[model samples]
Target: MGSGHDTRVAVVVVTWNSAGVIEGLLRSVQGSRLDGSVRLIVVDNASSDSTVQVVRELMPDAEVLQAGRNAGYAAGMNAGMAAAGDCDSYLLLNPDIRLGPTTIQSMLEELRESGAGIVVPRLVDEFGALRLSLRREPTVLRAWGEALLGGRRAGRFPPLGEVETRAEAYDRRTEADWATGAAMLISRECLARVGAWDETYFLYSEETDFALRARDAGFALRYTPEAVAVHHEGESHESPALFSLLSRNRVKLFRSRHGAARTALFWSGVFLGELIRAARPTRRAAAWALLGNVRGVARPSS
Candidate 1:
């Protein structure tokens, strides 16, 4: 892992019952082709399984922070960053992500050269299909349009949605409102200027909130396709609890950014969207959960 140049990086992997995938991710990190000095820190959010033990056994050199309770991803990441100390960059890596050998070097190079405060790698599935990680800022009109048109088609037409799910969209490196937090490389300068991840998000939309904050603070968010990572996605999609959290948090994020008027409109759009999706057999339960949580979705306890 030598380019004969030194760039210090602290890789923070947040885990929650991630024993099944984290070992491979850590191993991939150990075999990374970067020339930088890297510190691996695993922040586990009170995983009930053997995630902590597995991380300890497989990657003995990694610093492990045992957050005794389920603090959620944002808080867990903050804990990892607190432990990581100072570094040129902080990578908020998801436990289920496996990085390629050249991933770190390529991303770091783009970040340094492009002057972007945050840069994310191209995320693909195990079979090499692109995952739509990039996204535009959320707005009431976009939300309503997406509800009426569906994500895939709505995303293709920019005004219709916030999601950028088109495959060809990832062909070039570009600036984005936010990308998936699964494997983001954030500059220390950005962190210092914009502050830490907003813990109020609990889980979903935390990255969105952070990215928007960085942009507002004059930090650019970039998507560089040269660096690639594989993500075992769909964990949230499979869980009704997570789906409900995502639903509520989507509205929360909109409210935080646009205020009451837009939030109300966006919430209505989201409800209608869920109602439409619920018509499908597979999404019925998740749709019900989301609708149920509409009035009583608990806010993050700060």
Candidate 2:
């Protein structure tokens, strides 16, 4: 690890019609306390709003890359990282996140101390409520566990679920299988070894694929509780189409890593979970989408 004065960092933010919430993130970046040089790069995914204008107006020194079209999050992240040139580390952030003054520095320190290729900070919502951001590797058993019992309930038992929801788990630094992509710091070496984010996933599960691949390459994914950030979440929770995409991507990601039989079992578990929730009006679309019954919904480019 390089000394504080010499470490170079690149901060990448991918935006899509995010003008409303992006200002806070930009201001947080501006207010960040770091010892080394930091480059700010924003990749706009053909947002119809003033997201680009807002970025330029607030962060004139930032490198803004127009993606030309509304490519997915992975594509925008790849574009921003490519435009960033070289750096010791890359901090990937969401437009709705607010960083503490020393969030970046704390993450960097944890990365150096733990020798982790990727590090994620403790995430909270705007209300200051802790978010269950950590996840274990996806497996058929875990999938069934979540399907039978809801994520929050199943997560109480480590082997029963993928998401780590125990409050005590977030009280200290520990290695994770993966975590939410809203805020993460990736070491240069890990980025080099893992290559780029898999555009195949487009948005959801892309971070999981990258983190798992890093672990496959013998790099640890560490969670540093001291480095905290506030994430306002995203549209996936409310938008049925986005939620459907997230569910579909989970199956796709699991299939890529497991055998056909296991993938089918995993798919069954995911489908059952969606099916169980289908009675609710809010979950109807995702349930239909998972069953291949929904149409006219936009899908990620293949």
Candidate 3:
């Protein structure tokens, strides 16, 4: 129902203890110039730092919604979407990302041209390294391939893997199974049809679930290198517990889509892969994380 001219985009950013990197993100958002209307919304997940205060001070126009306690990323994003009201598109961004001036404008142009429900931009690091963001849906065989051959090599061969690490199609606009959730512009129609993000995932794999569901609903997920954003990837996985939790969530996501039989096989590949990686002297921490999840190998059925 949206043409290029009369579109409205609501940018939603969910923050959790991100006072260190949020200022740059907010400033970049304020700097983005767009042809269509744009509104900024920040949802703070009860950070002990001054993340909320910084948003209020720097980006006063942005709607700041505070969750009294840490509500996790999916819940915070959902809350932000609820506060966004009516809009033709929703831009979900991580607080550590800084958008290029024309990022939103370019994405809007692509949305109108391609008619894709969800579109993501190219993500680079502070060092200007291209972070491969596109991914293939996880499967038992792909999991084994990734676990054995590594992400980069396995990604190149689709029949054997899920992570799309090849950078060939990054520069040219194309459809992808899913891209990182760091910066994505999603159409209003897709959101209404696909429904809200699965809040059950506390942190990781939420984007994958959303992307898969969107694809299932006949919506396309696209990647455009024209719109670039810098993601200061967080050190969340630096914590062994969080790493274990993330691994657990991956299984849950796989189970939700592929059923128990495939999940069991996927889990086996993951466990073997982690075990092999843990054998190295530098990966002792990973060994502990894997050992801690012995009981968590199988998630409870929903």
Candidate 4:
């Protein structure tokens, strides 16, 4: 682990037409209290908006890399990491996140003290409501549990579901199989051992794949509540295309790690869950998308 005062952290932000939302994240990062040096690297995935100009205006010293085209999130992240050069840690952040003044410091301390390879901060919504960011490893049984009992109810029992919805679970630090990717700190060792984020996953499940691989490589994913941040949730909830991509990626990720029979079972559970929720008008699009009925749904560029 790098020394507290000597640690060098690279903050990598990937932007795609995020001019409106990226400012808060950039400003919060500028205001963060870190004993170590910080290198800000912004990778723009061909944002048609003025994201690059905004980044330059807010952080003049930041290193901005133009992706040249609208690459996916994983590809954008990989490009940013490559340009980050040598650093003690990498802070992967979404443009919608607002870090606390001591968020980076707290996560660094947790990473150092606990010897965890990856450190995730506690996340709340814009209204300050706690978001369920923690997740267990994806499995067929958990999928079935979610399909039958629902996520929140099934999550109450660890063996049943993947989402960690228990309030007490976030009150203290704990090890997680994986968590949301909005904001996380990756140690240099972990980065070196696990290598780059998998580019195959255009947007979702990339973090899960990385976290699981880190665990397979003998690294722990630690959650530290002391480091808090606010994340404005993305469009996956409202956009059928994004939601479908999310669901498809979950199955793809599971298939990569499990056998065909198990994958089929997991897919069935996910299909059933979506089917059940399709009764609601608001959820009908996502259900149809899951069944490959995404007629007007365009694939996200970033």
Predictions in order: lDDT? 0.86, 0.89, 0.83, 0.88
Candidate 4 lDDT by residue in tens digits, 96-213: 9999999999999999999999999999998989999999999889999999999999999999999998999999999999999999899999989999998999899999999999
lDDT of 3 by residue, 260-292 (tens): 567778887776676677755334455466556
RMSD of each: 2.3, 3.3, 2.9, 4.0
TM-score of each: 0.94, 0.95, 0.93, 0.94
Pairwise lDDT winner, candidates 1 and 2: 2
Using TM-score as the yardstick, the better of models 2 and 3 is 2
Native-to-model Cα distance after best TM-score fit, residue 92 in candidate 1, in Å: 0.8
Q: What's the true lDDT of residue 166 in model 2?
A: 95
Clashing pairs in 2: none
What's the lDDT of the predicted structure labeled candidate 4?
0.88
Give the per-residue Cα lDDT of candidate 2 at 157: 93
- Model 4: CA > 4 A from native: 1-5, 280-283, 293-302
Model 1 lDDT-worst window of ten: 293-302
C-alpha RMSD in Å of predicted model 3 compared with the true structure: 2.9
Give per-residue CA lDDT, model 2, range 126-174, as digits (tens): 8889999999999999999999999999999988899998999999999
Per-residue lDDT tens digits for candidate 1, residues 28-120, read 898798877888999988899999899889878889999988898999999988888868999889988989999999999989999999999
